[model samples]
Target: MINAKEAFLKASTELKENGIENSTYEVREIFKELLKLNPFDIDFAQKELSQSQEDLLNDAVNRRKMHEPLQYILKKWEFMSLDFNVRSGVLIPRQDTETLVECALEVVKQNNFTQCADLCTGSGCIGISLCHYSKGLFTQGYDISDAAIELATENAFLNSCDRFIAKKHDVLLSAIGKYDIIVSNPPYIKTQVISSLQSEVKDYEPHLALDGGESGYEFYKAIIPLWKNALNKGGYMCFECGEGQAEEIVKLFEVNGFSQIRTFKDYNKIDRVISAKLL
Candidate 1:
């Protein structure tokens, strides 16, 4: 018979004890999710939770207490101010990737690109956000994981991105269609270091979306030259990379005959994105 305030406090305390940095925020989000209330629905936070809601909240809280990602527990994530359906097998859309999206947006708009392709497009956040912002631009997003492809497709519809298409594909193996813009937030974590990551990433997030081979540049190495065949001359290629990786990634693009290479920082001032043109 727990009330809303009690439930919030209990969940907050549990998360805090487990070292969750944003316990209060997570508790409110979890409460909102379990109650099917809006994020600002403070009134719901004042009411008593029914038995079923309480059970569901406890189960969700338990998952978070076990280091499950809050987004996964909630089954949705926000990116580019757009909602995306996320699940266990697919990588969650993150705010950091929005840096890449911002850069891609600029390139696409400046070039008035009509076609774009997203490789390793988990959840279709990049491609869908691009399409949502620029209606009528044709975009295709590819993911190696079928689960990710499905999730991306659902997000495309949920966000009314009619021009976005998703398909199961291994970016490491083959290149897709040519385009005026290409973007990706491919796996960038070093393979050997994945196990040392936070439990939320190491245990919960799919490894196929995290492991980037011995040097964390395996995907870039594979895509830089091969994907060139999929790009129009003077078209843009953008990427979201790990911290301190943008410089090296620029060199990779240079070797692949890309120029006008530039990097951008995120809100935290981390060098998180790189954009280049194939000339």
Candidate 2:
């Protein structure tokens, strides 16, 4: 029977050979999950694996070999200091998106926008995080997909945003009430680029949460104008954009009559958030 250390090394090597970039961490998380033992736990240090435990490790190894996202396997993901439940149909919350939340919080803090809307609020990460951090704001989250709405509500509840409402509303067609701050990390990966993404994203994640049309700015184009009437006068709009999209997104807001257009960079210095106010 294989021991935990031997099992982990073998699984890590196999995952690496299959192109998993973070093989060691993946293997460690898998071991900790299956054995219910932390890496530093004395029990893990002394335990011998039973046959069932060995089989579970082998199953996880095989799943990893198939390029399944570790987050999907774990059914949870972290964003903005919170853990969100994730399934195959929902977008996996990403750290890059935290920049959107941060920008929104800062805008509200600076301008005192207490009513906000999170459009295309998959998993409710943006609005929920804002509610958690902003304290006094009333936040609402909307998504077109029923599955996404369900998961978003669950996430909102988990994050203690019971006052935050998650609803099913397609941004392309729905008429939402005015808000002092509007924000989204909408689907922005170009349709063509979707197929070219790493398998962990292209294969495992929801296409509805990706596939941002031919030029990758369809949602921004469609929603920015709709938001023109939905934002209170002098209210702010902020969005998370894909790489190389900040300038075009700023242009979209400008064309829609938004002023004071600004772009902020993520920690990696990528132009990741675009902010503007209705003139």
CA lDDT, every model vs. true structure:
0.88, 0.86
Which residue pairs of candidate 2 clash? none
Per-residue lDDT of candidate 1, residues 1-279 (tens digit): 777777778889988998899998987887666666443664755678888988888898888899999999888877888778889999888889999888998898888899999999888999998998876579989988888888888898899778999988888888978898889999999999999999999999999999999999999888888888999878989988998888899999998889999999998999999999998
Give residue 146's error in model 1 in angstroms: 0.8
TM agreement with the true structure for every prediction: 0.96, 0.94
- Which pairs of residues clash in candidate 1, taking residues 3 or more apart in a chain or in different chains? none
Candidate 2 per-residue lDDT over residues 218-254, each given as its tens digit: 9999999887788898999999998899999988888
Give residue 75's lDDT in candidate 2 (0 to 100): 74
TM-score for candidate 2? 0.94
* Residue 151 error, candidate 2, Å: 0.7
The reply for model 1, stretches above 4 Å from the true place, is 37-46
TM-score of 1: 0.96
